[model samples]
Target: MLDTTKYEETTISTTPACQEDPTGVNYRGNLSRTIQDQTCQAWTSQDPYQHTKTPANYPNAGLDNNYCRNLDMRFTAWCFTTNPGTRWDFCAVGYLDPKCQATPACQEDPTGVNYRGNLSQTINNHTCQAWTSQDPHEHANTPADFPNAGLDENYCRNPNIENTAWCYTTDPETRWEYCAVGYLDPRCQATPACQEDPTGVHYRGLLSRTIGDHTCQAWTSQDPNQHTKTPANYPNAGLDNNYCRNPDGVNTAWCYTTNPETRWEYCAVGYLDPRCQGSVV
Candidate 1:
């Protein structure tokens, strides 16, 4: 739970001028650049939101503890809102005459450093940023040309990642890529997207935790519309049955459902989720 005292700045101070560092140095009005003890790495975005490369003469020192000292959610736009078209930059500088008044007199980053453009995650009760190196087009690690290996039963293991005819393929890295949320690769365990194999089974996605005696798609988390899980990943969801898809979605192949009767209406055909006893009931 959020401490109301801290949110209101009653226990803390908002005036950057009144802020202080660990060494007892008062930071009054010298907020232009990073000062070892005074300036914080995480803060409200600059008045004129800047992204891509760090800009010189950038205004706004940012909030101290990544806290929303002042939130004007009434407006359609917000400081925390990100725009991926511009690499998840914050709201335009003059959009809402934006201002993120953060609470707490102390700085979030003592050293005052962070990767300029990266996604943040909660780590050890602190917001930790990470590489946003996103490659949505799946344009890497593809072979230009190769002779097919003889057909075999142990081939095409990762058809989801690499959709090539693996039975005749010849290589261990056929469909190698980063792991997904519920299907973390045992070989690539160090990635950020990797999830623990909770069910002592692989390839179940979130279904790794078996419901009765089965895996992913056997039992879903929620209506697919609100989540990102899709039939491509959870093929066991049944032929054209989108119930196992991500939540909040409407007609997308991702898991979705307005109600029980129409659950499989929009699902892709020829795809039978493993849970339907090989087909729908």
Candidate 2:
């Protein structure tokens, strides 16, 4: 019997210091070989391996030719190797520090969650109150309450499922406000988290297909499968098109399956780890 493991990663020497990207999302260098020294395969070609992650599907992942990219938002950027024996491997890339940036120019935050820019003012020209202060705007979105929300100073952030990055305004009348501080650049948005959202309500990541590689049914349509989770009903649930979401508060983000037999199914949510596969309907 033939071994059927799709990706069998090989252990190799440590990548040279010159090639290292911690986040693996913003490494646009020319390091075209995997850590195992295998030449990277062209993203457009499926000669050695027939894969689903293509440039056409992930236009923002910077899948230029064959350079390693973190399309799945993995620990780092990786690529399909040209060597038929080896399936894929991580590459040497640099983690562009998110704190080094001064302003929010080309920084793309699709979900507005990973925004680490220093945008402290609302669209109405109101200075945002510090996350630590509660003088005028006494709310629970403080550093003490949500530590990992990047509640530093008063930078706009979408810490907890807000429409976009926003902050508590210093203006007494207007307690809080949303900030227009994302998707300014057409380059590529920041990579989303690789874990499944527990509530699946705030999962704005881009995984349109289902776990079984089936195309998801658009949320706007009530075609083959009719259900209550529609864009009109759940306007704030990010129920756009065929993208998967847990608007009804399911265990995880799911979408109405295009297959009439299967009404709906959970999505992979960008996680491709072989160990944690989700169940299919």
**Most accurate candidate by lDDT:** 2
Q: List model 1 lDDT by residue over 1-281, tens digit each.
A: 76687677743443222121211112122222111111222344542334221223223322343322212111111122232221111121111111212321113321112111111111001121111211222322222222122111222222222321112112222222221111221111221111222111222232121111111232234543234354455455442331223333242223234444433332211122211212222
Question: lDDT by residue for model 2 over 131-182, one digit each (tens)?
Answer: 9999788888988888888997888887886767789998897688776545
Clashes of each: 32, 6
Instruction: Estimate the lDDT of model 2.
Output: 0.64
Q: Could you say which candidate leads in TM-score?
A: 2
Our tally of clashes for model 1 stands at 32
TM-score of each: 0.16, 0.33
